[model samples]
Structure formats: structure tokens, C-alpha cells
Target: MPNQSQIFNRVVSDQEVWDFNVFADGIYLITIQAKAKNWRQNFKRLFSDDDLAVQVDDYLFTELSGKKREFKGPGTWNGNELKNSSKSVIILLPLKAGAHKLRFWVDEAPMLENISVEEMNPDIKEKLVLSLSHDASAIDFIYKNIEIENLEVKYNDNTHSQKSIETKTDTDTIMITIKRPQDKKVESVIVQFKSTIEMNYKIGRIKLYQDIILSSSVNLRSQPDDESKILESLADGEQINILEEVVIGKFIAGKSYVWHKVGAHGKIGYVLSSFVEIQGQEREKIIELIKFWAQKLNIESSYVLALAGCESRYKVYATGGPASDDRLGRGIFQLTNQLKIDLNDDSKPFYSPISDLFNANQNVAAGVSYFKWLNTTKYKKSTESFKKSVVAYNAGTGNVPVVGKLNLKNYEQQTQNLVSCVLENSQKKKWGNIWWPILLFVIGFFLAAHGFVTKLNYASAQNDITIDAISNFEPDRSIRISSATSSVDGMVYFLANTSFDCGAQNCHSVLFQLDTKSGQIRKIMDDVFGAAVDLFPSPDGRYLALVALVHGGVCNSGVYYDIIDIQSLTNLAISGYHSGRYTAEYVGDNKWQNNNAFSFSLTQVNCTGTQRGTRKGEYVYNMDEAKLLMRMEQFGPENNG
Candidate 1:
């Protein structure tokens, strides 16, 4: 059945060659020549078949049809005649009008010296006969040129003699059914299109759709080329702002790749475009909440935002339960149970329930309240008040070191870094300028007054005989003369040892206002006792401001201060004290600016022995009204009282 179809052949070696295409449906003949002498031995080892003498396997794949097919069968082998040592097999290729791939291999290596395909005549009735002899190397030839038509092939391997075939044809569609051995689950059909057609579908350029980050961390380079220097390594999910795209002048599988110049973690670098995806909107809600609270709190929104980021990274339901001693600190601002209790105490006019802290708004409100209080009281509106408040917010008022002490440097640096990052990303303005001159003046005045009081205290100690000077005085007597101050009118109102003991049935100290002119010492009232005693006489000397440790008895150990009327020897007003194992001291020399009003420093410690948190602030007390006029501000280091 030879016709005018072209006959292709070549002397191939141990290499792959891509050639030929099928444009019609017909039976085709394929020929292979093995040049190796021990081909049969290698074939048996490759397929793990000891008895296999002349088996050959062929594979074909195509891109357009996305299919793959494999064929395996026996071929002729001759050991005597080297020139006639070859294999021949018939393949029925049912293909559409397109290019197709053909590959031949023996023992897992290229063995076909040449491969040729020629169509058989459709009118031929008798099947082509082949001699099954070990030395038969000549393959029967067939040729026919006809109009393209759909076709299907059916073949059976010796392992499973079952055969089936299917075919379908449409104006633009072609289908072929392949029946594999029973042990094989399914078979792959391979089809290929012309190289020109495949080239038309290749990707040449990409457009920037949105910002993105790599699926995993990757090194960011200073240039788009692979040889460029690496500037930094970006983490997965780190945001990227794309500036431009670059395409490499190399093609991979008929497609080119792209690179992008992006800004990541404050650095600009180039990264592969394929590795990244558009940045997500997951943290948007958290950012919005931070902004809302920051605006409401009247602080720099960026600072608040940065604080929140540093604290809990904008996690609204974040809890310090497992991390804290009391299992407190809930919500974004991490409001503690102690703070909630203080806020809800009936003694305080500004009271709110602790449960309200679970709500993000309320938690932020509480945190902002404390922040504002710290800024206004402890830092005193200094230029670095926000930063100081941030530090205090983290370490608590008790943990903050005194001003000018560089403790907490690491914590300060960490907070500064977070603040700087937030500021870089945000457009919020810095806090208003502070009145530096006024603050400096106040500090200078306090320092000068402190020096003068220290000198005066030294003079008084040298002249006065203390109880410690007593010859057989017991240290645990729990009763000692604390201090003595002379009134403006020549009256001596001094604190002295009383019979009352803190651990005994009745325990308290008594204040005596002595009139030297009359040589009469009048007992005023039972007063508090502390480690140290302080007495502030009003400018008129009619009232005395006394700060001392309240004796521990039925009441817990604490520090207390009260305004006492010298004539009546009764406490007009008491403030700056709390129950528990605590202590208090005068912050600076008590000042009597006027007869009716006097100011003093009260440093208070909450938990005594362990030294938890302490508060030190200046307070103005109104003697006539028997009340505290105002809390001037917080100052000095904790436990410095």
C-alpha cells in the first residue's frame, strides 16, 4: 500500500531529537536501531525482567492537548549480524490536524538510530505481516496520502489481551480512547500544536495590580538583577509598596519572569514578582480602633498607636492572665484588676465597674486616664512627657526610676523604636511644646529649698538631745522621741514617746504643745508613729502638719499625715495614707505658704516589705476647711519619701 507520502529516516545515536507531526489519522510504522552490543542485558536490568529479550518502550507528550501516552512491546534482536540489529513496531496514531511529539527509548536510554512515519492506505484489506525472528531487522513500509479524518487505535499487550477503542469528530474537536493493560488504571493521550502556535500564547509582560509581600521570607536586593547586593531580608507578610516592575531578558518555557522594586520594612529593594501576593486588610480594624482612642485621649495618635502596638500588637482581646501574678490585665490596654478596684472604690468620686474593662473602649479609656494622669502629675508636662508616660505605662508608677537616672534604658529604647516606626508610617503631629522655663524654675526652687532645709535639720539635730542618746535605751521599746519644733510664739510642740505600744492593747503616739513661758506641757492627742516623723508648723503657728507612721494594731501598718490644731490638740484633717504593710515620707520640706493653706510632699508605699508600687506627690491642705485643697503633682523617685 505504498503511496506519495514522505519517508523519513536517519542514523540516530544516544540522544533525544524532536521532529515530525501528524496531520491525519492512519496506521504508521516506526523503526529503531540499537547500536549497543549488550542491549538485551541492559534492557532486562532497566525493566527488571530477566526473560525480556527484545522489549522496547516509547513515550509521547503534548502541550496543546495536555496528554501523555506510553507504548511497550517486543522487537527483533540479533547478536550475530550487527548491521541488521534493530526493532520495528506499528502504531495507530489517531490525531487531529496539529503537531504531535514522538520519543523512542530502549532500556531507559535513547536507542533509535532513526524514526520515520508513513501512512497506510485505507483501502487495504489485508493486514501487513511481520516475521517474528531474532535476526529480522527490516521493517515493512506503508504509505498513503488522504484527506484528514478522525481515527482511533486498539492494541493489546501480552499481559492483558483486552482491547477497546473510541472515536468522536466535530468541526473543531477531536477525541481518542486508549485501552491500557488491566493492571494499568488509566492512560494519558498526548497531543501537540505547532511551535508557532505555542509561542503566541507565551507570557511576555506583567502589570502591577496591588501591593504585596512574599509568601516566605526572601532576600531583598539593591537591583533587580540576581547579582545585585542584598540590602535586607524581608519577612513573610511584611508589607510592600510596589514602585515599578522589571522584566528579565530571558525566557523560561516560552515565558518571561518579572521583578519588582518595593519598599519593605522601611527599606527599598527589588524582589521576584512571582513570589508575592497583594497585601491583605487584616489589621485595618485594629489600626482604626487605635486611631479612635488616640484622638479621644488628646495625645498624639501615633504615640498611642505605637504604644498599643508595643503592648499587644493591636489585639483587642489580648490578656495578661497567665503572664501576670494576679491573673489580671485584660483587653487591649491591659487594665489590671487592682486598677479596676481603685476605679470602682466607693471612696473615690470617679468610680467605674471593673467589668467595664472588658470592653475595648472602656479599657482604652482607663489606660488613657492613667496615661494622662502620669503625664500631668509625674512628668509635669515635660517635653518628653509622652515618652515618660509610655515607660511608666509599661513598668508601672512604682517601677519607674527617678528622673536623671538612666535605668530602664533597654525598655526606653524599645519603646522609642516602636514610636519611631509608628511615626514614620503615620501623619500625626508631635505633642505641643512644653513650658520648659517654668518647669526648670520649679525644680531649681525645690533644690534650693531642699539644701536650706537640710542645713537647718543638721543644726537642729546637733543641738537637740534625742531618745537614742539615753543610756540603757532598748531598741525594741517601740517608743521614742521623734522630733521637736518650736512654734512662732515661743511654744515648743514636739513629738514624744507615749505609753501606747502598737502591738499592745492600746497603741498610738501623742503630740504635746509646750508653753515654755508658762512651763506647761499640754497633751494634744494620740498621733501616728512611723520610721521617721515630720512636723510642719503653719506660718501663724496655730496649726501643725504632722506626717508619721500609723502604728499597727487593729489597723494595718501605714503612713498618715494630718493637720492638727495646737490649742485643741485634735486632727483637723487627715490625708495621704492607705492600709496594708506600707510606709510614707515627706517628699521635701513642708511649705506653709500662708496661715490657712500649706503644701507638703507625701510619698506613699503600698506593699511594705516587698516594695511593690509607690506614689509620691505634692498636696495642698486647707487647714480651716479640714480637707485637701489639691494634689499639686507627682515628683521624685519611688520609695524616696
Candidate 2:
């Protein structure tokens, strides 16, 4: 028999192992020396353990051999010390030869000052030598024990100039240690590790067969168990991303109800699975589809989504009102029979079937198409126009107030609130607090710049007029006015066509001008047949600009503006200033810059085929020279005034 002695000094957490080779089998005595008071205090504080137990394991051959020996050293507590000189000993007899392993499992991380392995031969008086030492400046330990099934652990070591030791148990526990060099002093040791677990459910990854409509509102909790804290309250038909199903506790019906872990707007929570249908495409897929259709229709996807949230909350079979009223709204868009009248026209190639409203794809297609038509035709294809369309869809076309009206009803406010909610939710989903403010700033800057330029132009035009010209002049009579305005030189201009049959083939508009000093009112233009008309006066009162519709009807009519001299009451010969190919309609009021220059916007109204949407144009005219200063066929940010 050979006699040997070995010592090991290091810091360990949870579990650590050491392997060595022996020439012969003999009796051995193992002694473990550690700082009892400091180690025990730190261990108890970190691991919430009342007593720290050091477990030692001796294995013969491989770990799978099932031949193992276990030994427990003296337990240490906050106020207790070991029986012997801060050390414990375990004796082993008939130790096997060849490779052998020793394992130490501790309740918490502790500093091992020394460990001595002594091999004594009863026949020989000498002891054999085997010693190991580890010096670490800092050690960090992290342990995670989660009670979950089908668990998967992922470990990442990001320590700089340090070594890491990792150990995992079959019972879903992970232990990690970060060891730094002895010479280096770190302010603090950070052991970072992450683990993810996916619980297997009875059903594999499968497609939902129908739309999930909640029977009622339900609380979304942090955990599957009912005792978990409530994260949020989900309304009926709210879309959710279902991760997996679980059964945690007993239900109210004395049966186990399935619970689902779901994520929405960066929030993860659990909800009762029975509350949802578990059908239709995933929530993200539906959102993407809405975005795709909105882009194709040149509408804001957030607006469309907001409308869906208000109308049906993204439910496929959501219905509104009774069938007897013929006002039933169906599907995510909540489309009604009245809104689909254009589909019933036999002139069109395809018609939407009433039954198709229950289908998600068909319903979205029809709704987007109808909304596009409303924007292009029913409204003027502006932001305000989109708002008007939303109102009209909620109420009726007759209830839509004219532009400049302020007393909006409750439905309008509700629609606005819905739009805001959709935008907020969308921003949370996509931007995550980064890009939304930048986007809003850009939009606000453009609007401010446009307003500043408009005001500057107006002020410049007024600079050419004398104050006496405005104060001295007065209108001759109190004329019935539809829309009226006064020039800086004390001349009044008004539209006499207060109302007209806009749908008729021949609708007429009349323009009138009044001189304040002379008490004279005269007709500037009359019998301007078309859809709509507007009038503007030059600053010096020398010219009146008339923008009128001309031709057979609203759909086919062309729009033209004429600068007429007040002295001669005759149109000026401004070359290349007439509408070409497309009918132009005025947007807002025209601006007169001084005596010679003036600007106005026109939107093309008679475009066909793919160009059915309105194309805006801007024009500036030199009235004195009788020439066109500028003509932009397509006006936008690239060519803004």
C-alpha cells in the first residue's frame, strides 16, 4: 500500500468535482478546511438557508456504474462552528484503484481554504502525496430552480478575463460560477445567465379553424394559476398571440379549464382558453393583412385598424343591430348592405356576394374597396375627407356636416377616439418608443412651414394696399351671401349661387362684385354651369378671379379660372393657364399676392382607370403681364408653395 496526502483550495457554488488516479486500493482520510463563521453567514444570507450542509460523494469507476459512496461534513450555521479546527474529516476503507472522483455539493457558495486527501497504509507508516490548489480573486454563483416540464436551458457566458463553470440537473436546476483571476480586483461579480422553458401541450402547432370570439371580458394574468396577479383586462374579440396551453388549477365548474399564455403589444399574460374560439389566422397575420390592404388603397393602416377595432374588434362573424333593420354590419370591417350598393350594379364585372361578408378575406377586400371609393368620390381625398368617410360609415351621408361646421355629434368623437387608440397600439407594437416622436415632428414641421408661407404671402399682398382704401370703402347693400370676402381696397366679392342641384347635368353658379364708395353692385359672371364654383378678388380691387366648372356635368366637366378686369369687366388673356386634359377643382380659397401675382390650387377630377384618385396642381399667374408664372401638374412636398 502507498501513503499519500493532497490538499485543494478554491471557492465553489452548488456543486464541483475533482478526479484523480490511485495506484492501489487502501484506506484514506479526507479533511476539508474552510472559514466557518464568514462562510456560514454569507451562505445563509445568499441562499436563505438556516444551516449550510457540505455533501461529499465518492464514485468508483464511471458515474453510470451505480457504485457510489456519500459522506456529510459538520453543518455550519450563523452562530455555530465546527467541532474540530474549522475542518471536517471522512474516512474511507477498501478504496478502489484506478480512476476515482470526488464531488462536493454545498447549500451556497463558500470559500474552501484547504482540502487534504491522505492515503495511509496500515502496513507502512508513511503517507502518499496528492495536492490541488485554486486561487480566485472573485467568484460569482447563480442558481435557478424552476418547476416546469419539457424545460430547456440556455447559458451564455459574457465574463471578461474570467472562467465559467456550469452544471445542470435533470430536475430543471442550473448552477453557474464565474471565476476571475487572482491578481485582478473587480468591483462586483455579475453572473448573467438566462433559461427558457416551453411546456408541451396536448395539441401540437396547428392552424386555428375559426375566429376566437371571447364570450365576455376576461382578466389576463401573469401566470396560469388563478392566484397570479392580473396584468390586464381583455375585451371581447381582442386579438391575442397564443403561445401555449396549460392546466394549473381547478375551474369554477369543478373541471380543469385550459389556460393560454398570450402576447400582445409587447405584453405577455395568461387567459382562460375557453373564453376564446382558438380559430382563424394568428393575430399578427390578420394585422399584416390589414396593413397590406390599407397600403394598396392609399389609406393609413392605423386608421383602418382603428375602424376595425371600433366596428368589430377584428371578429370575423361580429354582427351589429337586428336583421329586420337591414343595418346589420358583419365581419372585421363591419360592412353593411347599404355600403355595398355599388357592388350590386350590373355594369360592374364582379359583385360581392352577401354570404362572402362572413369570410375574412372577402370581407376585407370588399371593405377596403368601398372605403377607397368613398375617399375618391364621396369626399375630396384629404385627411379631413377620410374623417368624413369614417363618420359617414358610422352615421349616414345626410348627417355629415359641411366643412367648417364645429358642432360634431357623439359618434364623431367616438370615431376619433378609436383612431387614436389604434395609432397608439400600432406605435407600441412597431416602434417601441423610438420612431413615433420623430415621425410626428416631421409632420408638424411641414404643417407649420405651410402655414407660415401662406400667412407671409397674405401679408405681402396686403402691403401693397393703403389703409385709407380699406377704411373709406363700404358695401352698397346687404346681399344674401353663400360665401363672401372683402379685398384690401374695400371691394366686396361674393358667390350668389347659395344652393344648386349638384347632381344635375346643368348646374349654374353666379359671381357678384360690389363697390363700397359708389354703392354699386354688379354681376361679374353668371350661368357658370357645373358642380361647384368659388370667387376671389385682387388686393387693389382691379381684378376678380372666378374658378368655375364648365361643360355638361360634374363627372365630365372641366374647371378653369379667369382673371377679369373690374374696369372693363372682361377676361384677361393669360396664355397656358387653362385646365388641360383633366377637370380641376379649387381646394380652399385662392391667395392674391399684391396686384400682379396670385396663386391657387386645383385637383384633377376627371381621371379614369388607374388614375381615378385626385391629382393636385398648383398655379401662379401674372395678371398684369397676362402670363402664367408657374404651372405644377402634380403638386406635393417636392413643389409646395
Candidate 3:
């Protein structure tokens, strides 16, 4: 038997042989020793004559990874204890990539032990799996600001399969199963996690023969309406959940198109699904791209996704192919020539002017790259709010007005232009927090409910100060108002219930930011919460504009911090809240005064029991000073009496 000290850490001394074997596509790693060998008691830190240069199998490579990222260390990199250890380095090599015989390339003689081998393999193959995945780790997506503990996945026993999964807390789990046709063999199983819908799409199953209906418009010149002809009629406000697009046919010059079928619109036809992603795909792609680049750029993927959502609806193209004659953008992000371009191609106009943005992969890189610069450069000193910079992005650099289709007066446009100019006065004036002030996070992105949902269903830490921080206001329970704007940042803000035209309910709200440069409202968010409607931005954008149920009559509750510009829909800011409850919004912006403030006044009714009015329900008074938070009472005083 070899020396146990070597088993623990130190290598066998003098005349000893060590044996090892490696597996295919796996790596063998060894940790570095600290002071076990007792090398001559260090009289003067010098290399010992007996110390041999550390050598691993010729194929193996050394690496370091972690919170602090390291290069070389004890026998191998690990989450073990060491003073001020922020990172760990390891000697590693793939088992099948040649050279299994690794002889620790040690510079000094030392004992090695606890030969633990951990393979941090890349799941690049996972992306190729064409199956719906239930594994949270399989694809990154889910609820907002949540730390998922475990995700539970269920498998059908009838199918021959293997599965491994765990349940997570405070996290939403996506379950999936693949329905396959008997004729085709699965090339590979790629579980696509549509974080937007909280559904796992199994792409492994072969495509089945299915037929869909066309709008049957008699006037339209039959199938495949002039590709790129910009037929507003074909848009049809179709609720189709486009599966995917391919270049099926072509016509007209510079007008070739990729055809796409819809699940929501319930038909098949061609529209510009080019940058128009499948309903759930957008969010999933965002996660994958963000995670990939986050690893590369050392930033949070969520923040990147959030910024992309805010800037360009995550669309890369500046002009709209379908609706952009009006100038709306496309893709996971919405970028504009209005913004500066550090990375540009300028060769292919069809391709992104920002060269890196031309490719989907590169698009995320460019988005994050631009944001990284902004975060460090522009907003370097302003630690207060995200208003101005976002405004600047929306408004542009003194020369142009950036986003939004709503009619703008010359004054507002000039103000926006001015704001951009002022923001650009310096090089890094626009860089700051990449993502902040969430407006709302929908259940999933444009997610189509998979398992038959007629009805929809539906946070830690303290450290407080001012009394103004807390809401004396109460939310109304089960009341709803459509198109009523809230005074978040004091502009047009509303939470209205919308239909998918496919009978799906989607809640939507408008989020705004104040252009620090112009001091005008810069609504910088996409609205549409989910199922439950009546959610909107606050007059000031500090708190999400919404109404919640309280003691009785039902009132409006402004969910604070629910304002994120990335979400397709707004989520109540509270991490944990009942989903089925209905809420209402005040009629207009009368209840709000400015950003970070609400014009709410609270009054508690004195109730000693049997008094008719008081008995019926708890009433909030001073309608003039206090906006209705929620209806604490549903019925009349007689009911309570």
C-alpha cells in the first residue's frame, strides 16, 4: 500500500510509484499542497535541490475557476478551506482526449490525498437535445429575482428513459415530455427550456404532419402574401405562437421571406418572423446567451437580459420589417442607430449595422458589451436612479429622438434630444447600473400555457429607515379597472387586461423613466404581466402601479419595485403573493406627484363593532387625500350590520 499521507495529500517519497486511470470526456484533477512536505523549514525561501518540476500527463492542462478565479493551487482546485481563498487551481486533462497517465507535474515533493475528481463538463450537448427538459439546471430560466432550490421533473414510466432532478424552493419549475412519431429516430435530445412560458420544449421528437388554417381572407392574393410586401392585413393581430421559420419560398427583389406558422393565431402564413422569435424562445435564448456571455464577461446574465429588454425589446434591428414603417424594432432586443456603435460592420445593410449584433450570438455580446461600457463609463458617479441614462438611450445624442411611436411635440422631442446631448457631454456619462427598477416580470415571456389553463392561478431582508419608505396604504382585494393610468412617475401609466385573440389573458402596463437630460417622462419598459391584468407603472416609477385586496371593500395597491423594463408583463414586486386575487387601479395620474413619491393619504375608520357603516367593512376615508387602495368591504353597511 502507498503512504496514507500521500492518500491524504503528500506524495510517496524516495522510491514510490503512483497509478491512475481517466475516463472518456472526463478530466483527472489533483490539488496543490500548502506546507505538508515540511521542506527544509524554510531558512531562506529557496527551491530545494531534491524538488522535482511538477508534471501531469502530457495531455492535461492546469486551470483555475470560481468567485475569484485562480490559476495554480493545492493538488487541484476545490471549494476547500484556505486562508483568503477566493479561487482554486487544478491540474486536469480529459480521459479520452489522449494521455491518461498523469504524473502530477509537481515542482516540489509533497504528499497528495483525498484524490477527489470533479468534472465541470460543459453542457453544450444539452442545448442540442431536442426535448422538453424539467431539469432547472438543464436550461436557465424561471421567476424573477428568485433563487431556485430544486426543480422537480416527472417522466412517463411507459417510455424507456433515465432522469435525474431535484425540487427547488422559491423557484418555478418547468415540466416537459416529448411526444414522438414512430417513424423517425431522434438525432439528439435537446430540451429547450422556454423560461418565458415556464415550459420545457423537447425538440428531440421528430416533426409530425400537422395542418393549420389560414385567415381565409378573400381579398388577399392567396397563399404566401407577397413576401416582404408589408401586408398589414396578414399581420391579422394573429396570436400565433410561431414555432420556427425557414426560407420556404422566395419572391420579389430584396423581399424574400422566411415563412412562420402560429400556434396562437391558429394558422399558417408568412409574416416577418425573422427577428420575431417564437413566443417562449425569446426568454430562453436570452437566458442562454446571457449565461454564456456572463461567464465570458464576468457579469450577471439577468442584468444583460434586462438591459436588452429595456433598450430594444431585445430586438437588434433598428427598423421594423412588419410594423416598422411605423419604426418599431425587432428581436430579443431593440437597438437603434440612434445609439453609438463601437462595433459595426456597415457592409450588409440587412445584417446588423453593429457587426457583432448581426448574429444572434453576437447580438447578445454587443448588447452586453455596450452595457458594460455604459455601466462603467457613463453613470459612474450617479448612484441615485436609472432615469437619465435610460432616457438618453431612448432620446439619443442631441441629434435624434430614439424610441417610442406615440406622437411627440417638438418641445418634447427637443427636450429628449437635449437630454441625449447633455448625457453625451462626457464619454462615460451613460454608463451605470445595467438593470434596475423592474416594472413587472410576467410568469414567462409571451408564454402559452401548455397544460390546459382556462383559469390562471397566481421576499427577504430588512434594514430600514424613514417612515416614508413604508406604505400606510392598503390594497383593494378583487377589483379591476382597465386602461386606468397610475401615477407612478406621473404620466400615462395603466395596467389593462389584454387578450391573445386565442382566448388567453395577458396583463399589460407602461413603465417610464425621467430623462435626466431633458427632465421629461422616459417610459423605458415593456408592459404585459400575465393572466391577471390591471398592473402598471407608478407615476414616479419607484413602485409598480397596482391595486391589491386589503381588509374589505378592495382597493388599489402599488407594488413597489415591481418595475423592471425587461418583462413581457409586470409581476407584483412582493416575492410571495397570492396569484388569483384581483386588483384595481385609480382612473388617472391624479394620485401621484413625482418620481419616488405617491400622493397617498391614509385614514383608518374607528369601528366599535355594530355600527352599520363600520360593521359592513373597514373604510378608507378622505378620497380627496387618499386614493382607494383596496375595497376592504365588498357589500354595504347593512351587510356588516
Candidate 4:
């Protein structure tokens, strides 16, 4: 037996050892042994998928995965035995006569075992076996099938007539077939009964409330109760679906009214019928509240609808849909509730107490304000980063790795892209053929499926646009064309539009006018381009003496410097910004002593800063190199020769 006590000692050394039961034969029932919990915590890690840790493989032990089960709440297991006579353990199974290995998990820890099984009764047909396994993927697959619960195991002793065998169980156990229950045809009830005894009414969550019952001899007190008490008395409006009635009487002169809970998790408990009034399911009212918050938050109504649909399913005080505390992810977005205190309290607590999550304005305001704050402070102005914050909000921040002491440039750029990618990925849902836009997300044309469809040359307006390398024939003269070339010299003279953040609700565009003599940037169009184009075009455009130009770095071309008639600002033959430091000499018809020196932008930054892993190298025009290039161009090959 390998001293079963040794196994207990190993586990108990880490956690308290609780109950253990000897079933029909060598089959045993062992509970957790986490001692600090007064040695009573047989089960640990409340939010976990037990099936992932345990695999009862294909051995010929017994077959019992398709049976019904339930959680008989609040049972306890002492170090070596089941206690409290409560139904914490549910599965009752009969093991076939054989030698087998059984396994399960304790807080995700693997507990593997080899065991010999024996039946209690000779005719074991009356009793069945119980076992479980899970879908292979992550939690996304958990909600897809049947929900199994409290299972019990027992044996019938006809085993002496049957032959015992030893078999290896690497493959044969079939996948457990889960039977999903059909949606219940809910029948709504409308029961109106005034309280014979005073009742408290709560405005928000009812699960957190504690209640006290009055015996048949207490007197009724008719004073206004505290606000907290009233709120606690409220129940889940869905209780109206069952139409359960206790048929208990009101109150007598000598007796007091009973205070009973109108809502329960799954247990069929008694409630004082006269204490609560059923107004039917509040689905419509709940929806209206959700919409109100959506508007206040400035999000689309459908976004709010989708949010509520994903969360409590529009059921205020709704629980049991899924355990919220799993992996520290909770609330509407499913992001980790990083803030430790009761976020509901806006008063005595540091952030102040919110009276109710059901309050449309407050709830919506909170959701939007949280996201908006994240967008502004952590993400700068990138829409993509905003989306990541949204995902982290729903999935828990544990996924966001905190890389310590990274180069600031890489930190900012990579983190921004990370968040943006997350936000973009989460909005996808499978559909046929080409994916389409979701009404709730408003992500614009086909996206989410193919990833974020960042603006592909929508070319709105220009903001802080700089035209690089405008040249003049002579250093003295800032006008007139000198021999010049650009990094992107082949493009059209039209300025490429670009964007700038105006530090307000929206972005603004600007046209770039660079001083040919210096690298300074100036906005050229105050009213001209604004009125000419639709508001503004978000592309870069620069003006050289006679040159008007636009540049595209991605096209792998050179800068376009359009030369124009100074007065007319009309077109003329353009020169390019030759790199490394090239002097503007009028190879064409130009006089010396004319302003011919041209300057080229060393680099362009839409949002400035280097990106480590993204080929974002810095560009600097070396003064010494520029001077040397000028001397080489002016003196000819004899300098090197």
C-alpha cells in the first residue's frame, strides 16, 4: 500500500490534509489537507478547471461520465474523514473488479495512483461508476457542453462471480459525451403581497446581505430602516421565472413576520411569500438601464448592449453564469480587477462609494472613464494601443509581461503595438467566407478577422508635415533652384497629408513649409489648404523655394521638391535632396551668390522615438561628412586623387 499515510504526509506538508474514506475495496476518498484553514479546507483554488489536471484514461475500471450530478453545498472534510454530513462530495461510483490507476488534481497538482478495485454487492447492475474529463482547449471550450456536478460512488457486491483482469489504459477510454439541457420554458409569476412585517429594500446587489429571522412571537417595528438594509433586501429579479410559492402565512398579533431570502443559487429553500412582491422579469427595464449608460459613456448603444450581453447577460445581480473571480479576471470587461478595495465605495473608501451598478449613468460613466483614462495616460494617441487596454481589461493583466529596464524607445513603441494588437484581435468572431463588420464594435470595413485595418492612405489632412531637401542655386540666395536631389525624388509634387494631435477630442492636420536654409518646420497652410481640401489631408507636404512636394517613405523613393514661380507659387523644374551633404550648385541657368543652399531632413517621425525591434534607426546628417561631400563635389576627383 506504500503507506497511504506517506502520501498524506507529503500533501499535508504543503496543505492541510482533510478527509479520507475507504470505499468498497482499495478505492479511497481523500480530501485536501490545508492545515492553516483549520485543517478543514478539503478543496482549494475556487476558480479552477479540475478536469485538466486529472486523466482517468482508458482502463477497464468502470464507465460513468454521462450521469447527472449536483453540488450539495457547504460540506466539510476533516483530515481523514468526511464531516458535517453535508454533501460536499457528490460522485457515487462502482468500480469493476480489476487493477487500475486513478488520478485527480488538488489545486492543479497531479495526484496519480494505481489501485485494485472490488465491488460491494454481487449484482453491481443497480450501481453505476462516475468519472470526468474535459475538452482539450482553454477555457473558451468550457461553456460549450454539459455542466457536471456533485457525483457519488457506491458498489454492489456481485464481483465474486466476475473475473478480475489487469489492463493498461493509455488509449481506450472514449470521450465523455456531455448532454446539454434545453432552455427552460420560463413561466413568469406576478405575486403581490405587502409585508406584514417591515422589509428592507436594496438598490443594488443582494447576495452580500445577511438576514435575521423573527420567531412567531416577535412584535413588528414600524420605523424607517437604514439605506444599506433596504438595499440588502433586494433579490435577483430572475427569481420571478420559477414562480415558487412557500404558502406560508403572514403575521399574528403575538408573532413576528419571517425574513426570508427571495433568491437562492440552486438550492430550493423557503422564502417568506409575504415579504417580497414579484413584478415579473425586469428584462426590458434592465435593457433600458444598460442603454442609458452606453449613451453617457459616448459608446455606441450596441457596444453597451454587447457588453451587457457578455457580462451578466442583462441580469442585474446575475451570478453563476461563470465564476468571476477565476484568475483575477472580473467585472464587465473581464480584465483583472487590479484595484483591491471595494470599487463600489465612493464615500468612506478612497475613491468614493457608488450606490449601484444598476444606475445607468454611474455604471456607463465608470466604464468609459476607465477606458478613456487608460487611452490617454498609458497609450498616448494610438487607437491600436487603446484596443489592447480593452482586452487586458477583460482577460486579466497577468498576460501583459512587465519587461524591466527596457530602452525607452523600444518600451514605448512595442508596448503600444502590443496593446493595439490585443484590442484588434478580440473583436473577431467566426463567420462564413469573408469576415464582416460587427455592429457593436464599429471598427469600420473588414477588420478584426484580418487584424486591425489601419488607415491605408485615407489621406485625410496634413499636420506638422515637413518637406525635406529644398535647394537653391547659391548659399547667399534662399530662392532659385540649385542642383538638388531627395531620398524620394521621383514622386509627384503634391504634399503627402499627415496628422497631429491637437491635445483635444480629435486630431488635426498641417502642411509643412521648411526654411531651405534651416531644418525648422512651419505650417504653410493656415486657410489656403484648409479651404482647398476637405478640412485637411493627413499627409506630409513641404515647400522649397520653387518646389512644392510630398514624400512617401514606404514607397522606397526619394523626396519631391517642386520648384515654382516665387510670386505665383506655380510649378517649375524640381531639384532633389542628394544625401550625405551635397551643395546646391546651379548646374542649370542660375547665378552665383544666389541663395542656393538646400537642406534635407535626416529622418521623419510621425510619432517620434526609436522602435527597437522595428528597424527604427536614427538618422543624423554628420556635419563633417556634409562639409567633406561639399568639398568633393566642388573640387572634383582631384581631392581624392
User: Relative to the true structure, how large is the alpha-carbon lDDT of every model?
Assistant: 0.42, 0.44, 0.31, 0.26
| C-alpha RMSD (angstroms) for model 3 | 21.1
Better of 2 and 3 by TM-score: 3
lDDT of 4 by residue, 107-133 (tens): 222222222222223233222232212
What would the TM-score be for candidate 1 when compared with the true structure?
0.22
Cα deviation of 481 in candidate 3 (Å)? 11
Cα error, residue 266 of model 2, in Å, equals 33
The sequence of per-residue lDDT tens digits that candidate 3 reaches over residues 294-330 is: 5566654445555454343332232224432323333
lDDT of 3 at 133: 19
Best by TM-score: 3
Give per-residue CA lDDT, model 2, range 1-641, as digits (tens): 34344554455553355555667655454544453334335454652322223322211111111111111222221123331123332222333456554554343334556555556443532222222133322222212222111212122232343334344332122223233334443333222222432221111112121112102356678876656898887776565655553444323221123456776546887765435434323344445556655665567666666566545545454555433446667666877777667555656432444445555655776676666565556766445776677666666666765454423334543344333344444434441111111111112111111110101011121132111111111332111123233343545554433232232243344455544334344556554344335556677777777765555444555555667787787766334544444444445447887888878766655444443445576778876566776566664332232
- Candidate 1: pairs in clash: 12-113, 68-188, 509-527, 529-549, 530-549
For candidate 3, the per-residue lDDT at 353 reads 34
lDDT of 1 by residue, 340-452 (tens): 88766757533434455545445665665565567666776466665567666766666565365434334543344333333333343432111110111111111111110
Location of the lowest summed lDDT over 10 successive residues in candidate 1: 450-459
The list of candidate 3 runs beyond 4 A from truth reads: 1-268, 271-282, 291-303, 311-330, 337-341, 345-358, 383-385, 398-641
TM-score, per-candidate, Cα-based:
0.22, 0.26, 0.30, 0.21
**In model 4, what lDDT does residue 15 have?**
19
Q: How many clashing residue pairs, candidate 4? A: 87
